[model samples]
Target: MVSAVLLAAGQARRMGQPKQLLPLDGKPMVWQVASAACGADLLEVVAVTGAAGEDVGLALADLPLRIIHNENWSNGQASTIRLAVQSLDTRAKAVLFLLADQPLVNKALINNLVKAYRESGASLVVPRWQNQRGNPTLFDLSRWRTELLQLTGDQGARGILAAHPQCIHYVDLPGPEILLDVDTPEEYWQMQQLWQQYKVTKG
Candidate 1:
């Protein structure tokens, strides 16, 4: 089974608000990402919440998500990632880690990453659109679960990917807008502008 674990616990210190709760196309940003992940019809989709845990959970409550609350959210990104990895089903052969801020992530992009991992058997399946590399990266559980669980503070398995280039596979992402991560107020505004353009094209 291949599962998706979304990291939604960020403090968004720059944005001065929970980016997960930020509205995108009338729904919370996290909801958009979660919906896409679930819609991909993968084995499972888990959302790890920190910061505004209850609010985030409530926002995603209607969706079919396995929500996990990270008490050590203040620790940094790695904390939530490790927590999510711990909560995965033992049967999961691969896990995709998604950025909560990437609301542009859609079912098609997610399925592409998962499908590539399944057929390519790459240790890591990353998305690339032109020159941009984006998130919702997939990792073969057998290859990186140990290292993932070993992540400390804000550390992630990207270091391992950097160390071993031979095992990484790059899948062509259908859209470059999926690379937008709303870390600042300016980016959020940019996302809002891009959203309009993206939907019209998507439709």
Candidate 2:
């Protein structure tokens, strides 16, 4: 089973506020990301909340998934990741990690990565657009479980990807907007614009 993990624990120091609760398409940003995870082909969907844990919880309360609050969230992304890994379902053979800030992450993208993880023998299945690696990466838990647990402060799974180039299976996406993430106010605005474009195109 491939489990979907939505990492919604960032403090958003650059945005000067909790970006998780920010509105996107009439729902919270984290909600949209988690929704995509739930819509994916994964068996289990887990969301790790931090910073504005309570508010984020309320936003995601109606979703069909489990919530994990990380008290040590302030420490960094690594702590939240570790907590997420520790709570994975025993049957999960691969874990797809999604970022809450990337509201543009849709079900199709996630499903595509999961499909890659299943078909490719590589340890990692990542999205790339014009050579730029993107979020919602799928890691073969059976292979990278130790590396993920060993992650340190502010560190993410990128370290493992960088260390083992041959083990990565890159799925090139059509455009870069599909891989965009919100960090600063300007980035959020740009993402909102992209969201509008997507809505119209898919409408």
Candidate 3:
């Protein structure tokens, strides 16, 4: 069975606050990401939190997910990833690595990745948009647990995936949403406007 790990332990030093708590479409940003994960056809979902763990926890209180606190979160994002990887239940054969900041990624995107994982048998599955890889990657547990624990720097899992490109499978998505990440106030504001436009079109 496949599982999911939502990474939300960053200090958000650039944004000056926890971006996970940043509001988007009437709820915390991380809540939207977590909600999407909950909608996936997976065996388990765990949200790894640090820094402002309690506040983020409250934001995701209603989601059906296991909240795992990363005490070594100050070390970096990789530390939180290690914590989550270690917390997986025995039933999880693989894990989808998700980022809390990518609120635009929906359940359909995650389900698409899961479907690809079950079909490809690749050691790592990463989403690609216009030929660029994106977040919410999936790693086959049997292949990368050792390398995952050894990850220490700020860059999350890219180095390992790069070193083993033969094992990495990419899912081609249609939009730039896969490349958009809310790191600055301007970007966040732009996303809000875009979301408003999308809503109007749907309405």
Candidate 4:
């Protein structure tokens, strides 16, 4: 079975506020991502909180999922990833790593990744847009759990991907949502504008 890990522990130093709490269509950014993860065909969805643990928890209170708080969040993304990996269900065959700020991720993309992983049997599976790798990458626990446990610093799974290129499988998908993340105030504002346009177009 596949499990999803929503990483929501970043300090948001550039935006000067918790990006996870930022509103996207009247819901918290992390909530939107977690909601999608919950809707996906996965065995479990785990939300990892760090700097904004209390607020993030409150944001995702109603979601039927597991929440984990990482005390060593200041150590960087690696700590949050490790925390989620450790908290994952032992029955999980693979774990999907998701970012809280990527509000555009949806259940379809997640399901597609899982489908690819099941068929390809690759050690790692990730979405790629125009040759650029994106967020919400999946790793086979039986294959890479040891490597992931040894990771440190801000680098999430990039090191592992670099070290084992042959084992990586990319699922080509359209759109910049997989790569676009809200990091700074300007970027957040841009995302807000894009979201507004998207709503208008959809309606």
Against the unseen true structure, what C-alpha lDDT does each candidate score?
A: 0.88, 0.90, 0.87, 0.91
Instruction: Extract clashing residue pairs from model 4.
Output: none
> What is candidate 4's lDDT per residue for 1-203, written digit by digit as tens?
99999999999998899999999889998998999899999999999999989999999999999999999999999999988898889999999999999888878899999999999989799898987888789999999998888889999999888788889899898677556899998999888887787667557
Candidate 2 error regions (>4 Å): none
lDDT of 1 by residue, 46-160 (tens): 9999999999999999998899999999998888888988899888999999888998889988888888887887889999898676687888888788888888877566777
lDDT score, candidate 3, position 13: 87
Q: What are the TM-scores, per candidate, against the unseen true structure?
A: 0.96, 0.98, 0.95, 0.96
- The numbered model that scores best in TM-score is 2
Model 4 residue 37 lDDT?
95
Q: Give lDDT: candidate 3, residue 37.
A: 89
lDDT of 2 by residue, 45-147 (tens): 9999989999998999999999999999988899888999999999999999999999888999998898888788878999999889888888998899998
Q: What's the C-alpha lDDT at position 109 in model 1?
A: 86
Q: Write the per-residue lDDT of candidate 3 for residues 82-188, one digit (tens) a residue.
A: 88888999888898988888887778889988899889988899988877878888999898888898899688898988899888888998777545788888878
Give the lDDT ranking, best first: 4, 2, 1, 3
Q: Which candidate, 1 or 2, has the higher TM-score?
A: 2
